[model samples]
Target: MSRVAPLAPPWSKQDADGINRWGHPDRTYEPLLLVRCLQRHPALTAKLRALGEALYVDATLPPRLRTIAILRICALLECAYEWGGQAAFWGPIAGVSEAECDALVTGADVGWSAEERTLISAVDELEATGSWTEQTWTALGGNLTDEQRMELLIAVGWYRTICTLCNGMDLPVEGWMRPWPG
Candidate 1:
């Protein structure tokens, strides 16, 4: 059970707005547990949701790279709620293979291309040290524009914040979401 239960409907206008504005199409109202829990703090929900939209919708980082970073971050944090939801929904849409998702969870060696390898390594480094090494930054530069690099860093921090929320709240994976891959 979640430490803080998700707020159910008859939502305040503010929460309804936040839900309408920020809810992920796949996750929302399949009970919307996370966003509804967040609606407990409406102001923060709005801001966080907006940031999420910026990262997922408006950012320059490619969707595939962003999804990879999210998977790695959630795996490292052991946040099953976020990891499962993303793996089930966004991962395939972003072309992240099941093998790749399993590799993320188990740290298995996979035949990822050079760019994919660098992105995984970068997420690992960030999880370990909270910043990328110069070598990793240089490697990223080959494939990512400056804006993309910045967005990647922000995505890392943003997803970490999300994982913290999911894990700390003891939020259950939605019934529709894939469970954590072995």
Candidate 2:
């Protein structure tokens, strides 16, 4: 059971506004458990939503690279809620294969390109040390523009924060989401 019960639908006008404002504008609102949990603090939710938009919509980082970093981070953090959601929804759309997703979890050598390997390595380093080594930074610079590097760093931090919230709450995977791959 989730430590904090997610607010159910048939929401108040205030909640509907918050959800609409923070959620992906392109997708129909579905009262995701995470969103409902955040609704408890509407103001903070709004702030987080803005940052989320910046990372997801406005950032210079390529969507495929961003999704890869997110998947690696979620796997490293063992946040099944975020991991499963990203793997099921964004992974295929972003061209991240099932084998790659499993490799992120298992640290298998899955024939990622050199750039992709560097990205995964960077995420692993960040999770382990909270800072990138000089070599990883240099490798990242070779593959990503300055703006993209900055965005990647922020994305890592952002997803880590999300993982913390989901894991701390023991949030259940949505029924529509794929659970952690065995």
Candidate 3:
């Protein structure tokens, strides 16, 4: 395992409550690891984070594709918390299979649609290579709406950052989750 970063402060009820009630994340809540996310710039962090969730998870992307992109980001970042948190579909919007999800983690394709396969492969390549191939953009760009394209494009960075935060904090995936591939 990689060395863990120093712990930040735990998020308090006040912080949690704010996030829970107001739907605004209090980045400062987790201090033990000194992520100091809150201190950096609340407005900036909040907007960025909100944009991330709004575009990637809550937006119109199919649940399967959304989860695939997210899980792929988790795999790339090796973040159990983010990967594990989305474990049970969290109600509706639950899509995809255990095998498919695992395939994402291992950089393998398990016979998804051309679009599905392309998106996952693109995300993987982006994570591994830092640049996307023209073919990826072409295949995806044609099939996706402008809105979806922008959302997915932004999601690459969004989930990437969120996963890093979870990994840095050593946050585990929710209890019910089974290491993705299981």
Candidate 4:
């Protein structure tokens, strides 16, 4: 993972009216997730950061549902870094136990809730064939609140975009960049 000098103005902790890098991992002096995150256009950076916070923190959607969607997305994309990042959340935040995460690791054993099954099946159908089946939508019971719906779509799109960037950039997985020989 070779480091590149910034091609544009770097946001200081002084940026964002004082929120600093912790509030914005992309604004950190170094790239936190994807190398492209460091070089992303300012507008996209803000949107991605907002989506990151929404996906991980806001809980506008049920954490379990959001995490499950992310897991399925990461698996679909074969984005190992994204999967590693998303998988770490199965316990502390999503209330999903290690046993469930283990089962999902194989996919053949997803043993999901009725709602979780509907969401994952929809995501899979959409990813594979570019749309959800009518039956899949019918099974999408009214479990998600309205706010959850908005954030969930945005969150899915957000990570999918990042997955594209990270893979296209050939960004090393986080630990692969550590103890940098360069």
- Which of candidates 2 and 4 reaches a greater TM-score? 2
Could you give the candidate ranking by lDDT, starting with the highest? Answer: 1, 2, 3, 4
Clashing pairs in 2: none
Global lDDT for candidate 2?
0.85
lDDT tens readout by residue for model 3, 1-182 = 22343323464654443333222243222222212333234455555545755763378766667777887888778776567554444212456777776776776657888888888788888888877777877787877876776677677777787777667656644445546553
30-144, model 1: which lDDT tens digit per residue?
5468887888888888888888899977878888999999999999999999988888888888999888887889988878889999999999998899898889999999999
Clashes of each: 0, 0, 8, 0
Rank order (by TM-score, best first): 2, 1, 3, 4
- Candidate that beats the other on lDDT, 2 or 4, i.e. the better one: 2
- Work out candidate 3's RMSD over C-alphas: 5.4
Better of 1 and 3 by lDDT: 1
* Model 2, position 54: C-alpha lDDT score: 89
Model 3 clash tally? 8
- Which stretches in model 3 have alpha-carbon errors above 4 Å? 1-14, 21-45, 56-58, 90-92, 107-109
- The TM-scores, one per candidate, come to 0.93, 0.93, 0.71, 0.70
User: TM-score of model 1 relative to the true fold?
Assistant: 0.93
| Deviation (Å) of 52 in candidate 2 | 0.9
Q: How close is candidate 3 to the true structure, as a TM-score?
A: 0.71
